[model samples]
Target: MTETSPRPLRVLAAMSGGVDSAVAAARAAEAGHDVTGVHLALSANPQSFRTGARGCCTVEDSRDARRAADVIGIPFYVWDLAERFREDVVEDFVAEYEAGRTPNPCLRCNEKIKFAALLDKALALGFDAVCTGHYAKVVTLPDGSRELHRASDTAKDQSYVLGVLDERQLAHAMFPLGDTLTTKDEIRAEAERRGLAVAKKPDSHDICFIADGDTQGFLAARLGRAEGDIVDEAGNRLGGHDGAYGFTIGQRKGLRIGHPAPDGKPRYVLDISPVDNTVTVGPAEALDVTALTAIRPRWCGRAPEGPGTYTAQLRAHGGETEVTAALEGDELRVAFTEPVRGVAPGQAIVLYDGTRVVGSATIATTTRRDRTTAPTA
Candidate 1:
C-alpha cells in the first residue's frame, strides 16, 4: 500500500527585493510549502527617494521584488502599507527625536508594521505562517511554547532588535534564512545561480526614512530650527548649537566649542537639556554609566520574576556586558557588572541568555556611579 504525502503549509514570504529575502522565498517553495510573495510599499514622501546604498522602499526595489517573485514562480502582491508605516515608523521616529530620544525606526517597522500588521493580514487570508529574511530562529519548546533564538551566523545576528517580540508573535513567525545561511555573500551567490535580479544589489544602510543618511537635515526639515546654547557642566555658556534635537548623548564631534577643556583635551557632549536649551560638554570619562532604567519593558518568552543576572546590549552591534536585571512594576532596572561607556537614553537595551533572547526595554534614563574614596588608613 502507498502512503499519501502530507499537505504543504501555506506561507507568506516578505520579499524586500534583496538577495536574502529572494532566497528565503525560494527556499520556502523548495520545502514544499505553498508560498506567496509580498513587498510592502512603505515610503510616502516622493523626495525620500535617493540613489544610494541606504534607501530600500524605492521604485527600483519594488520592481526587483516583483521580478524575484516571478522568477520563483509565486503570486506577487505589493501591499500599500504606506499609511501604517508612516504612522508607526516614520512619525514615531520624528516624535522620538523631537522629545530628545533616539529611536530605532527599523525595529519599530519590524515589530509593528511588518510582523504584527502583515502577519495578521496573512493569517486572515488563510496563510499558516509569515516568513521573513531575518537572521533569527524560532524554536518550539517541550511545553508547547515558542522561543526565539539567534541565527547560526553570530556576526549577522538580528536577535537584539527582535527581542521586543512577545511570545504570541514568535509563535506565528518563521525565519527561512536562519539555520543554514552564514554570510551575505553566500546568499547572493546562490541568488546569482538562480538568476535573480537583486543578486548583486547593495544592502540598504542607515535609516530608511532618512533619504540622505542626514539625520540633522531630516530633523531640521521636520522640526524646524530651534537654536540653543551649548553650556558646560556648571551651566556656563560655551557656544551655540543648531538644535538640541540634532545632538545625542556621548557625542563629541559637531560641538562648535572653540576652546579646549581646562586640561587641554577634547570636550564631549555629556548631556542635552531641552528644558534649558543647553548641551553639556565634559571629559570622556563622564560618558561611563553603571546603571540604566527602562520603561515599557517587553519579555520574549516569559518575564523574569525577581532579580536575575543577564547579559545586556545597549545598542545594535554593541558588545554585551553582564548586568543584574530586576523587574520593578512595568520598568526594568539594570546594573552593569562593569561600567559601560556611552549608555545613551532612548536606545533599546536588550537582554540575552546565550543564544536566546530574554527581553528588551527603551532606556528612559541612565545614572552614573559617583566614585568616593574611603577614610584614610
Candidate 2:
C-alpha cells in the first residue's frame, strides 16, 4: 500500500532498540497503522553478542525496545531467532571467508533473517507489513508494484544493504524513516519529544557479532590459526600471516612486510586463496578491475531483459560507479565505465537505476584491465 494512504495497516515494526527504530515505529503508529514492536533476539547466548551502545540484539536492547513500545503505547515482543541467524548469517560469513571471499553479514541478515524468515513469520501471523528503521523508501506505483529507492537523506541511505530484497519482500516492507529529509539529530530530537529512552542511544557500528570489533580475531577463533605466507604479485614471499582469511582485497595495512617495494610504493592485498592459504599483494595499480562476473542475482523487481547502463555500489559506504550490466543464465556480467579498486569476491554488488534499486548479486570473479594472472608459484 502507498505510504500516503490513510487506511490503517497492521504494521510489524522490527524495533532494534535504537533511536531510529523507535522513531520509525512511532511514526508508523502515528500514521494510523496498527503497529506492534518486535525485537529480534539474534543470539541465544546474550553475552556472546555485544551489549551497550556499540552493539544490538542484546538484553539491554530488548529492554530499551520494550520501553520504547511502552512510550509509543504499543505491544512489544521479542522473538528468538538465534538458530536461524547463526545458520544463515554467521555460518555463511565464516564459510565465505574460508573460501577466500569477503561477505557482508548485514546484507545477509536483511536477506536471510529479517526479510526471509522474519517476514515469513510476520505474514503468517497476519501482519500486513514488516517495518524497519532502514533509511530506504518503498515507492508503490499506480500498478500496485513496489520499488525500493534511496532515502531522501543521502547521508543516511541504506538501500545498498537492502538490495537483496526481492519483489515480494519489497511489496510487504515499510521504511518509515526514509522520506524524512531531516538530519539524524532531528530524529533523535523527535525521539526525545516522544519520550523514548533510547533517544540518545548510540548507533551500532562495525560487525555486531564481533563484540570487540576484531573481525580477524573472531575469524581466527572460528577457523583457528593456520599460518600462511604473504607473497608479492611475482610469487615472492613478502611476509607471513596467521591466516589468509585475515586479509581482504585492497587492504594496505598490517601486512608486516619487512622490505620496501622496489619503487618504494605501498603494497595492497590483491588476492586471497583459502585453498593454498596464500595472500597475494601487489602495487595499487594492479588492483584496478574493469569487469566482474556476479552470481545469485536478486532482483528487486523484474530482471533486466538486456544490458543496461546502471550505477553499482560495491561496498556499503562506497560511492556508486557507472556500469553496463547484462544477465546471462543467472550470471550478471558487469563492465565498469572506469576501473574500480578494492572489489572482492563474495561482496554484494548492488545495482541502481538512479535512486531506484535494481538488484544485487554476489561478486564471483573480476577481470583486470591488464589481464595478467597472478603468479601461481
Candidate 3:
C-alpha cells in the first residue's frame, strides 16, 4: 500500500464521536502524523443527546469525541458549523424535496460541509490534510495522480456518498479505515482495547436533522399540505394523496391506492411532479429505465479523459452495470446495458472506472424503454 503521508505533518481528524473515527485518529497518530481530533457540532439542537440510537450529532456525541481524543492523546476542539450545516445540508435537502426530487443529504454533507467547509477551515488553521473515518480508499495512481476507490469491505464501502468530492478535496483527505482488513467489530474491539468511550455506540443511520425519522411528517411540516392527484402514466387518475412532495420515485409503500392490480401485484410510485402536484403510480415493470441524463457533473479526477465506457452506480448500495457514457455540454448522458430500477431524479449518479471513482452528477431525467424497441433474434 502507498504511504498515507510522505512526511510527518499536522493533521486534523474529524471525530464524530464514533468508534470508526476514534480508531482512525489512533491510526493517524501511529503513522507519526501530528494529529489533533476535532468534533463538528452540526446539530441545530445542541442540548439533545443521542437517545437510544435515534439522534446523532448531539451533545453526547461531542463529549464522546473529546473523550476519545483524550484517550488518543490528542488535543480536541469542537467547531460549531450548525449554521452552515443548516443552510447547506438541511435547507438543500428540503428544497430538493419541494422540487419533487429525492435528495441524499449525506452526499450534500460530504460535498459542501465535511470536505468543503471543514477542509477549508483546516487549511486556514495550518493542517496538511483532514482525516475522517469514511470507509473509502484514496490511493496515488501509477502516474502519481490521486484516486478514490471503494473500501476493502464492500458491505461498508461509502464511496457512493464520498463521490461528490472533487480531486482537490480528496487530495487533502485521509481515511485510515479504508485500507484496513479490520471489520467494524474489530474496530470497536480496538477502541475497547484502547478504552475509548464510544466503543459500543450505535451508528447514526437517519438524517441528522430529522431526529424522529419520519421523513413524510418532517416534510409535511416544512412544505405544508399540498394534496394532489395520484395518476397513471396515461394521465388516468387512480386516487388522491395527502401531498405529492412527500412521495418519492420507486416507492411502493403507503401508496394508499384502494384497488388491487389485475395481475395481483402492487403499484409503485413511478414519478412525482411538484409543478402539477401529481404522483404517478404504476406496476413494478414501469420502473425500469434504460437511459438517464445527469446535470452539474463534478469530476474527482481529470474530467473523464473523453469518456468511453464507465461503470455507472445508480444508488448508494446499488449494483453497478456497464454503461456507455459521454459528456454533453455540462451534463452527462449514459445508456445502460440493462434497464435499471429505482432510478430517481435529484439523486446522484456516481461513475467509476474499475475501483476508482470517476465522478458524480445529479440525475435529471430517465427514459424507460418500450417493448417496440426490442431487437429481433
Candidate 4:
C-alpha cells in the first residue's frame, strides 16, 4: 500500500507588482496549485502621482502584475477595490488623526480591506484560499486552531501590521513566501532568475495614500490650518504654530520656536491640546511613559481571558518591550515592564507572544506612573 498525495489547492495570489508578490505567485504555481493572480486597484487618483515600481495599485504596478502573471502562466485579473479602500482604510486614517489618535493605515488595510473584504470576494468566487507576500505564516495546530506566526525571515517580519486578523481569516489565508525566504534581496534574486519584470522594482515606503511623507501638509489641507500657541510646561508662551495636527509625539525637528530652555537643555514637545490650541514643550524626560490605554482592540486570534505579560511593539519597526496587559471593558491597559519614551497616544501598541502576534490596538492615552500624583483624602 502506498501513501496518497494531497490534492492541489485552488489559490488566489494577490499581486502587488513587487518582487515579493510576483515571486509568491510563481512559487504557488510551482507547488502545483491552481493559482490566479489578482491586482487590486486601490486608488481612485491613479494619475495624481507617478506610479513608481515601489507603490501599490498604480497603473504601472497593475501592468507589472499582469506581466508577471503572464510569465507564470496563471489567470490574472484586476479588481477595482478603490471604493472599499477609501471607505475602510482612507476614511479610518483621517478619522483617527482627527480624533487626536494616531492610526496605522497598513493595519487597518490588512484588517478591514485586504484580508476581510478581498478575501471574502475571493472565496465568493470559488477560491479555496487567498495568498499574499506578507512576511508571516499561518499554522494549524494539533487541536485544530489556526495561529499566526512570524515569517522565517526575522528582519522582514510583518506580524505587527497583521496582528488584527481573526482566527477564521487566518484559517483561509496563505503566505507562500513565509517558510522559504528571508530578505527582500533574496526574493528579488529569485524573481530575476525567473525573468519576472518586478524583480528589480523597489519596495513601497510610507503611507500608500500619501504620495510623499507629507502627513502634516495632508492633514492641514484636509482640516484647514489655524494659528495656535506654542507654550512651555508652566503655561508660558514661547512661540506659535500653525496647528496642533502638524505635530506628533517624539518629534524634534520642524518646531519653528526660537526659545531655548532656561537650563540650556533641549526642549521637546510634551503635549498637544487641540481644545486650547496649544502645543506644550518641556524637558525630554517629560515624554517617558509607563502605562498606556488602548481602545477597540482586535486580537490575531482570540486573546487570553485575563491579564498576562507579553512583548509589545510601539511602532512599526520599533523594538518590543515586555508589558502586562489587562482588558477593561472595551479598552486594554498595558503596563510596561520598564518605562518607554515617546509612547504616543495615537499610535499602535502591538502585542506578541514570542514570534507569534497576539493582537493590536490604538493607543488612547499614556500615563507615567512615576510622575502621577498620589490620591488624597
Best by TM-score: 2
lDDT computed for candidate 3 = 0.86
Worst 10 residues of 3 by lDDT: 47-56
Assess the local accuracy of residue 165 in candidate 3 as a C-alpha lDDT between 0 and 100. Answer: 84
Tell me the TM-score of each prediction against the true structure: 0.94, 0.97, 0.95, 0.94
Per-residue C-alpha lDDT of model 3 across residues 19-98, encoded as one tens digit per residue: 88888898899899999999899866865434553325888778888888998899999999999999999889999999
Count of clashing pairs, candidate 2 = 0
Q: How accurate locally is residue 176 in candidate 2, as Cα lDDT from 0 to 100?
A: 90
Tens digit of lDDT per residue, candidate 2, span 1-377?
A: 44555588999999988898899899999999999999999988877778876427888888898999999999999999999999999999999998999999999999999999999999999999998999999998878888999999989999999999999999889999899999988998999999988888999988878877799999999999999999987899989999998999999999999999998988999999998899999888888888999999999998899999999999999999999999999899999998999999999999999999999999999998674554311
Give me candidate 3's TM-score against the actual structure: 0.95
Q: Model 4, range 181-224, lDDT digits (tens) per residue?
A: 55677788899899997888989878777776688887888888
What's the residue-level lDDT of 12 in candidate 2?
Answer: 94
What's the best-to-worst order under lDDT? Answer: 2, 3, 1, 4
lDDT of 2: 0.91
Candidate 1 regions exceeding 4 Å error are 1-7, 52-55, 371-377
- The per-model lDDT (C-alpha) reads 0.82, 0.91, 0.86, 0.81
What lDDT does model 1 reach? 0.82
Q: What is the Cα-based lDDT of residue 339 in candidate 3?
A: 83
In candidate 3, which residue ranges exceed 4 Å CA deviation?
1-3, 47-50, 53-55, 372-377
